[model samples]
Target chain A: MSQELIDAITDMREEDAVAITKKLLDGGASPVAVLDACREAMGIIGMRFETGESFMPELILAGEILAQISAVVKPRMQQGGEDKKLGKIVLGTVQGDIHDIAKDIVGFMLDINGFEVTDLGVDVAPEKFVETVKSTGAKIVGLSGFLTLAFDPMKHTVEALKAAGLTDVKVMIGGGQIDENIRQYTGADAYGKDAMAAVAIAKSWA
Target chain B: MFIRPDNWNQMSPLERRQARLDSWQNAPTPPFVSPEAEKNYRERISRVRKIYDMAPHDRPVADLFMGANEYIVRRKGFVGKDVIYNHAALREPTLEFHREFQPDVSVGAMPYPGKPWDMLDFKTYIWGGQKLPDNLAIQAVEGEYMLASEYKEFAADPTAFWMKKYLPRAYGALGPMAMLPDFPRISESVDTIDLLVPFGLPPFQEMLKKMMEAGNELMRILGEVGQTGAMVVSEGFPGMGFNIVKTPFDYLGDTLRGTKGILMDMYRHPKDLLAATEAYVPVLVNSIVGASDRTNAPCAMYVLHKGADGFMSQAQFEKFYWPTWKQVMLALYEEGITCYLFIEGSYNTRLEYLAEMPEKSLVCHFDKSDMKRVKELLSDKFIIAGNVAASLMSTGTTDQVRAACAELVELFDGKSYIMTHGCYFENTTDDKIRAFIDSVRK
Candidate 1:
């Protein structure tokens, strides 16, 4: 039954996945099994996206499917005491950059991967990052920037977080045309090429 | 009409270039214009000829490019005001500004009265939460104006679908557009103006009034600046000539589908995209060919917004981007027009695809590609324009600006190279801008 559910998601049969998830939950099947199956399917989808076999729509559609399954499974997991929150993460596009697509994607990926994600939307100032970190005690913060001009603000945000005694917080930057050079320039702990890498970094730090 | 070779990618770059040159060489000449227009055409041609005839070393720096709008707005002291609506007021200040700057080419104003999309309210609608409408010229707002699922509708009848379906979804002001019932076609004997009257209810009239007011202001501005033409010419400033022919893929991606949607379409609906792109070929050819005739300019400007690095993989670019764009360039080139492509982002890997153009037929103005590599690949085949780092102008010291400009000038050997910012500067001080401009003057 678990393998069948995973196969439905992996094949991107939305109706079948939803129906199977409903059937398993109603029949008193373990929520952890459903959750694991969905995670496996997401991993497959992310790999396909990375390899160019799948693109954004498929990624987005798969995310939607996962959201539906999570809705059914998350409640049951809590009842079963199987809800082990991965870690909390704070994500935002830095000040001076209003591009939010990448940040949103990273937030979505982290949320589905068992992390509690606080997404401060686009053009978030440094103070906001520090405040969110203080309030949430999230160990992972991801700075997003699509424009080269956003480098200064990203640097500022990272510095402010450190200066605010959030020294243990790991800062990761990602967006268009970024590399290790940009990561260093922004004083980030690390940088990811895509959202999956961001999820990996957050998981390691958290 | 463009026919792609079966082994387009297999053919060598040199062979592609040769093929394009051969096609252009054999294409029919343009038809004659009216005698008066012909005389004007000849005079304009003479002006361009005189500039081209000058030693590359002697050509003025200002002649090569126009200043970005942000720099001008800031410099002219209209930085915080409602500048878009008051564009006509810019005439006297602009004239004064030009006198001081003495630019070799006039940065032409946006079309007066403008279209519906140019209105401030429409801009506010599409991009919300603005103290003022953002400077779209500098910042890219990725709008998924059309979804991937709507490809069939868009491909079937683009005009009807956009007017009825996409416009309403894309902008708030156009929401009433969704109320427009489908027309099953009736007698043309009835007055069309009266038919449109019902459609002009409420907010429609307000928007119409705004458009008219904008149009009137444009005329006034033109009247104010109309006499400056002789002054501009006599002072050795030739008017800049630029006609736009948007590539179909960019049209779909930037304005309609958005970046993510179009990228997904490359994998999900490649054939539909190819069909839609092909459908656009004749529409573009007709519009641009007519514009070329009206402008009578030998050059056209095409700003390439997508197809840059990380936007798509190289394989996706070859399949979805290059074919239509290449056809457009070749078609325009056949009509004796040169293409000035403003490559908006890093196009390092995509340069080889562009190299297929006939030599001297393309002026590739790059924004962010590595200059050294771009020079190595394109200098022999194309006019390489750009890219002085905007950071140097806006933040760096005068010495830094001078050093960068001098290095680029030296690198290009002072020929077929236009010293320019990689893209529009966000903001720069006057002295620093002058320093960079002075460095390139030699």
Candidate 2:
């Protein structure tokens, strides 16, 4: 049954995925089992994306399917104490950049891969990232931007984290134009070319 | 000038393309400031033509992909808003940049006329000084202007879709356009009364007034700018971009369906998405051909978005993105207009499909694609330009910029290539741009 759920989600049968999730929950399958199936399906989709068998639309649609499944399963699951999330990470699209699609993808990947992501959303100031890190005790920080204008802000964000005495925080930068040179210029700890890379970086840091 | 023969429709695509190219080359030369200027202009045009013809030429022509926007800012200390709001202020600086840089092609004074946009309450883009800092470039705000279920209606009548659905959603002040009657439904005289009713309404009247006011403001800005292409041409530089056309896929993704919305449409309504994009081919073809004819510059710029490597798989791109866009390009090629495609993102996986375009039909300006691979696959077939990282231009040292430029020129061996930055020169420094242009000149 779980394999069936995974296949349905991986195949991008949106309505079928939702229906199968409900069916599993009703057929004495645990909510945790349903959630596990979702993670497995996402891993398959992410692998396909990395292999070029899939693209952004597949990732996006898979994320949407996961969200729908989570909505169906969240109420049936127990409350809070059994938490086994990998680690905490704060993410944003950096200052002066309003692009959120890539950032949101990174956030979704991190969430599915077991990290607790605090998405600060677009146009986030450096201080906001610093304060979020300080308050949440997240050692991982992801700064996203799709423009060259985001370069200075990324450097500033990295500097701001250090200035706030959060020097041990791991900063990863990615977007449309970012690469190794930009990683060095921004003083980020690492550069991720895509959302899966972001998840891997966060996992390694965690 | 080569007029279309009566048998134009009966001719093969290649024959029609040659006729159009002949028309373009035979168009009368613009008035020049001096004989020396005319001589320089002819030399530049000849060099470009040689590269396009896949023949040996003087040297690799160097042109700015998005023009000298950042150079003007750095040299003149003008903020982004100043460039948009003060149109006349750019004439001297633009001319000065052209004189100093001396690129083979000139993209002169790309002014946005913020006043008109502001007057119209344009919702599509947030320009400098409006929402962002005065120094930053304009950024588009994505929205789902066309809903997923509306694709059938859109494909049925794209003009009505624009007037009744798209325009009102794109322009905040044009909300009354939603009340417009479908013109195709009102063929008879008796049906004319209903069509006229919406125009009589106060809201529709108010929208028309606002549109006229915005139009007038745009005209005023244009008057100040004063035919930038002609002005530049008189000084010995031929212009490259006559007009702009978006790929049908991009027309859907960028304007109507937002990126997320379109991606979903690919799954939920693949047939509708394909139909809608196909519907846009004739619209785009006619618009670009008309613009090219009017400007007498036989080139149209297509900044491709939503069809890059990571955006979709090669199969999806072939199915939904490339076919209709190829139709548009082929239609333009028949009309004698060349397509200048600035392949905005990395097109590593999509290069083979691009190479499938008709020889001499395109000039691919790449951004992040691996140029070595691009040269191997595309250099023999098309006029390829670019892959200088915009990050390197903005943040790297002058020496670094020079090294990157030298590397690309050496790779292309100075043949069938145009030296240019990978993307727009926004946020780049004056010294780096100088290094970029001067490195090639040497």
Candidate 3:
């Protein structure tokens, strides 16, 4: 049944995946077990995306399927399933950049990979990142931006984190035009080219 | 009838294209400031025409893609909104940039009239001054203006879809356009009279009034911009990008369905999406060709989005993106217009497909693609330009910028390539831009 659920989600069988999740819950499956299947399916999809066997459509559809399944299983898990996340990370698209699609993908990947992600959403200011990190106590930060204008804000965010005395926080930057040079310029700890890279970076920090 | 020759219908596509090229070459010269400026214009146009024909030129051409906002902010200490709201504010910065840089082409400072946009209550784009006064560029706000289920209706008749559905969604004041009758069904006199009934209503009357006001504002802005364009040309900088075209896939992805919506539609409604994109090809071709004729310029700039490597798989791009886009290019090619495609993202994997474009029909300006790989694959087939990274220009030192430019110039050996920045110089400093042009022109 677990294998069936993973296959359905990975294959983009949206209705079937939802139906199977409900069936498993009704048939005495644990919510943690259902979520474990979802994570497994996302891993498969993420691997396909990395290998170019699948692209954004599959990832998006998989994310949608996972959302639907999570909605179905959340109520059941409310009673007893207290699954431990790997770590906490705060994420956002840097200031002056309103692009959110890539940031959302990175957030989804981190969530599925067992990290608690606090997505600060688009056009995030440096002060906001510091405020969120202080509030959430997240040790990992992902600054996303799709324009060159985001470079200065990214540098400011990295500096803001340090100025707030969160010097040990790991900062990862990625987006349309970001690269190794930008990573150095912005003082980010690492640069990720895609969402899966973001996951690997977070896992390493964790 | 004015632009086309009397034998246009009888001429073959190749001959018709030659005639159009001749017309472009023989276009009446703009009023030059002096004999020196006239000589410079003639020399620059000759160099550009030779490059387009893939012939040897006296030297390689160097062009800059920049906006007036960059100059205004850096030199005059003004924000984006200042120039966007006041059209004449762009004139000084625009002329000064060209006077200083003296690039092979004029700076593309197309005016984004903010007053008209404000009047229309435009929902599709967030202009510079409207929301974030400090924003450097206009940012498009993506949403599913056309829903998934509307693909069939869109494909059946795009014009009708635009009038009754898309216009209402894209512009807040144009909501009354949804009440418009299906235009094709109104053939008879009675039906035509029925169409006038909606115009009598207060809501429709209000919409028309707003549209007329917007039109008047736009005309006023254009007049100011036209004077600037004339000044730039009179100083001997010839313009390259006279009109713009969008790939059908990008048109669908950008304007109708948002990025997320279109990507999802690849799985949910592949056939409908394909039909819709196919329906857009002729529409795009007609619009581009008409614009080219009106401007008397042979070039149509294509800022391609959503067809890059990471956006979709090679198979998906081959199936959904390239076919309709290539058809539009081919149609424009037959009309003797050159398509200058700014491949805005990494297209390393998609080089083979681009190499299949008709020779001399395209100038592929790349942003992030590997230039070495691009040279290896596409140099023999097309006139390639570009790709000094925007980050390097903005963040790197002047020496670093010079090194990057020298590397590209040496790589191409000064043949069949135009030296340019990968993208526009929105955030780049003046010294770095001067270094970039100096390195190439030297």
Candidate 4:
């Protein structure tokens, strides 16, 4: 069963996902086995990278390969359940600004750790974010705005969320324009300078 | 030049005499500037300064960095210019991709030339419509700052109609306006945070704590894997700044109405392209300063193309960009950081304007500056970094890259140089990247 799980992560094959599922149903493998392999493979690639043995081009391709592999293996590995019903997340970039490279990095890292992120693409309207959070019953909302001009809309989105009666929800802010001072100015519960920081905040959020 | 391979140090009296005489024969003399011509140049600078007063450069706090120099300059460096330029040509509006080769997106370092250490992601895009001839070049520099590599081909990243984007300003010729509100201003506090990182933050303090922890663990294992073929380069520019874009002109792309276009538009509606830069200047510089300082590497370099002099003549650069640059330098310097500006191309036409820059105002990364003259003139003040041409990597064999690297290493010996290509290597083939590293690592 362990060998089978390792094979799936190595190949990043969709067929591996189906087989892993079959094994789970057959009571032959554990979710821990699958997750361990998934994380181990990612660790291998990342280690190769930090040493200058690798550069960005390879990291990107490898990241994609890992993502594809994880998608196939995730559902089965989560083994019919998630760890903490750790409330839902609605994330998107603010309006009039369409930069999300940083946002996407945050999203990927969040997903890696464990967060059900509803990522709205660039130039997202504030109202849509509020509506999505309300409808999905998600308690966490993340907004990203890259421009100072877009700060207005970010503020509007938070106000809209409060107006929509989701006041108790945690609101996290990030991107180039968001900082500890800016977060306070924008009235966000949490803020991070980059994706790695954002994921950590998400992990800590109540 | 002939050399005594065996007895390189041995020299007879006659041979030494001959060598001394030969050196005297080829010794370069300072180029003479006639009194009248020198006067005319000084007058020209005086006139320009009258038109646009030189920006004040305060006693900016400066930091000096010893070279994190690892690779032998006589050894090879990446072939950035060839790959980047070649790929850029492929994406040119009228030009066709050089058929025998296509732009490569993946780059890897192997234990050996034949082995793959791992591949990393390096993304690139071309800005469609460039506003200036050097817009793409500036963008390439910025990429080097942010992402830490200049693999972007010329004209990649912000290309097409995107380059011509001209935003309507609130007013016209309104000398420097107040900074745009809501924009982030750089703070020197980032330096404290950086220095404090090693002390170990509360895992809850910042997410980087966790990432750094993880990275530390990863580095340990990578150390083992690295025992075989070895990495391309052993060290990294931890606090290095990669300039991704040039200035605001390029920021607008083709957005600006030409002088004629603006003149015609002035009559049509007016508020179309007036002075919008005052607000953006601070915001952009703030981002540059903040991002660069955040990295905590005191030796940060910004990629700028106007040649060694500047895109606009000294007067115009001072009138428009210099104040902003000064602001950034001050903010960064306050954090005890030093900066290098990769000044590309020739500034010969406007050398006098750039000549009087304050003592070590900022390091001048020389390109077209007459090396001998600039070496003599600015060597004392600036942290000179490069002048090694990229062709040496592309056309010159590995040995050539080594020789060029050696020359740059030796010539700029005992000084700081962020050894790199004349430009970027967006289209550099795998073979060249391999050879370049092998020859230079020695």
lDDT tens digits, residues B1-442, model 2? 2467699879876666566655665567668888988898888877777776678986787776464555564467777777768777777777787787776777554668899888888898887889988877688898999989899999988888998899888888989999988777898879989889999999999999998999999998888776665677888887554477799999899999999999988899999999999898888887787777676665688888999988988788889999998888888777767788888879998888888887878888899899999999988878898888888877788999899988988999855988877766566676777777776665
Recovered fraction of real interface contacts per model: 0.08, 0.68, 0.48, 0.00
| TM-scores, one per candidate | 0.73, 0.95, 0.96, 0.35
Find the candidate with the highest DockQ and give its number.
2
- DockQ preference between candidates 2 and 4, better one: 2
Question: What's the candidate order when arranged by decreasing DockQ?
Answer: 2, 3, 1, 4
Clashes of each: 1, 0, 0, 61
Encode model 1's per-residue lDDT on B121-209: one tens digit a residue. 34312221233234323244677777777777777777767777776666545666655544555347675655575466876666456
**Docking level of model 4:** incorrect
TM-score of 3: 0.96
Global lDDT of each candidate? 0.67, 0.84, 0.83, 0.43
lDDT of 2 by residue, A1-206 (tens): 39999999999999999999998889899998888788889888888877778889998999888888889999999986455899999999998889999999999888878899999999999999999999999999999999878899999999999999998999999998898878989999999999889988888889
- In angstroms, give how far residue A29 of model 3 lies from its true place: 2.3
TM-score of chain B of each: 0.74, 0.93, 0.95, 0.41
Decoy 2 TM-score against native: 0.95
DockQ of 4: 0.01
